[model samples]
Target: MNTTELFLVAMLIVFSIPYLIWRVFRTDYWAPLVVVQIVTGVLLGPGLLGAALPEVYGAIFTPPVIASLNGVAWWAVSLFVFLAGIELDLPLAWKSRRESAVTAGFALFTPLLAGCAAAALLLLVPGWVGPKAATWQFVLGIGMACAVTALPILILLMEKMDILRQPLGQRILRYASLDDIAIWGVLAIILLDWQRVGRQVIFLVLFALACWGLRWLMQRLAESDRWYVALVWLIVVALGADWCGLHYMVGAFLAGVALDMRWFDRDKLDQLRHHVLLVLMPVFFLSTGLRTNWTLGGATVFLAAALLLAASVGGKLLGIHLAARVQRWQPGEASLVGWLLQTKALIEIIFANVLLDKGVITSGTFTALLLMAVASTMLTVPLVTPMLKRNPGLIGRSG
Candidate 1:
């Protein structure tokens, strides 16, 4: 087949396979369709499907097809991140700043410390650290990966669980939102290129000026017109961020945050997220899966994945439990919040991709982190359900 036809084949596989698995088996209670899509992507990657069917992988993922797929994936993630930024709810986070700050701090830092310990231990084993990484970079990068919470996936889960509009739900969003901002800040530190410091500084300065002008223009546009303008703004910011060496996603997010969330209808914004996931994000997941590797041996990757999972889960629970104690939260609240906050998917994958792109972690480490993210996310609903059932008061905080 020509590259275009082959690309369509690739697209068919990306959409059809995961959906079939999700719908056929009724995995919704345990794993959402989104999670299934991510898993399907991993299964279809070179480590598994590619190894078993090398000819198939080679043919469908030809140079041109792969390039085309990546283009779709880039835009998919760009839109997704921009939505996440628009949904940040900074005003709410600020209103509860004291509680939110304490919770976010504990939630983010504890996992970071545990993840750092796990990353350090990983160094004793070979094939986990990328060749281009400094020891500091690998350690911190892996640590931060462990600490990430997938904000988008968390929203999906909360909505499914019927807590999204609840007071407690908003509270959880506050904590996660604060941590989300910190996650990017840490990434900027990890991605800082001293030789390109001049470029990055210039980008920030110019970006600030541009944001003022952009927000001013956006404020004056009709709500309907704002939608189209936002897309243009997203692309422009992504391009500028990429050029400054900070990465396009950073720009996409900043572009969203610069504008007022009140400008967009909440329902439309939510639908946009759903549609983006349904159409374009699967390609991003497929592209993500294609990068998985097991050259260090599948068993080693599994073991490392297990260790990281323990660190991530244990640290998150510990951190939340501590905050619960301080805040004098009701019983069962800590466990529930921890399990929910531990949800990680696209954001974790994106963070790892950045690390891999920068050569801070090898494919083996990336695979392990990927596994950890999948496992952590899968555990969220099952773990939270029982607690919610037991505490009838916990369902949307008396709403």
Candidate 2:
């Protein structure tokens, strides 16, 4: 197949998936849409059908093409993160700061402790992973992977369930809002610890200055009479943060928050969401699906995959439930909150990509983590809806 044919095939998959999933089958087919997309990827790549049609497959998914796809996917993720930060109702977060603090602390530490324990256990088992170098990398990487949650997934779920207005939803959202901060801080510390002090210190100092400077500039930009200036400032802040070694999402989020003060027009956020999520995110996910490699299969891989799923879902549920209970939420509501809280969507995908790029994990491991993210999203939606409908009162009154 030539480049033209390969492009056509790529376009077909991209066009067909959304049309088949969203337009034809609608929401009823979402899970299958996800399954089909992933399975189609596996089949069309080196895994199954690709083996039978190696020439065509190789022509399509070459290294240069894959690299280009990743670049596009990264942009999509950056926008998605920015939109997430923008959508975050920081007022609500502040109102529930104590609960948010509890939830955030538990969410971060529980997984870190569990992942470290798992790493130790993995070290005990010979042949479970590769040699010492490989083992340490896998353990630390998997630990970070387990600890990460997808902020985009959680917000979408809450919106769909109409729980964003409710207390349980607010708590979860607030926790998620703070979760990103903690995640980046932990990651920065880890990255710094793993790097030379001079570079690390330079990055940290630059990041602090950038954050402070952006805050000042965004305040000024928020009052701009020209709409384009606001948008430009948003981009500048995002790009600046990206350049400073902070995630673009963090910058976008801070930009949003900075503009979110009482002076800016409330309508700006709605506009941001309209263009960002509706327009950009689907393209990103498609490109992400294209990058998945399922040919690297084995029982050990499957086992590690299961562990990641458990760590993500089970750990979040347990941590949130305990936190909710401490907040004096009833058992039913707390458990339901726990169940609802584990839905991870966008940020997890972004984090997986980051880990993969940083050499913290393999492509195959990232693929498994992505699968876990989709599964967690699907499970949380159904689990939370009944709780929302049947007992809105059960959500929580504390905060």
Which model scores highest in lDDT? 1
lDDT of 2 by residue, 1-399 (tens): 665566556657655765475556555324524334443454555655466887876777776665665566566666655656555667777776787788777776677666656656655545444222355555765566567766665665566566655666666766666777666655554455443455445655665676577656656753655346545656776776666556677766666655444545567755665566555555555665555544455666566566677777677767877776777766476667667666555566666666666666555666666676677666765666666677767765545
Candidate 2 residue pairs that clash? 150-348, 153-345
Q: Pairs clashing in candidate 1?
A: none
Q: Which model scores highest in TM-score?
A: 1
Q: Distance (Å) between predicted and true CA of 139, model 1?
A: 1.7
lDDT of 1 by residue, 1-399 (tens): 998899899999988998899999999989988898888887777778788999988888877887898899999888987887787666666777888888889999999999999999999988788878889888888888888998778877887888876777877877786787688778878777675677778888988999889888988999999999999989988998888767787788778777778999989988898899778888887777766554545587899999999999999999999998998888898888899998997789888988887889987888789889999999999989888889868755521
Q: How accurate is candidate 1 locally (lDDT)?
A: 0.84
> What TM-score does structure 2 among the candidates reach?
0.80
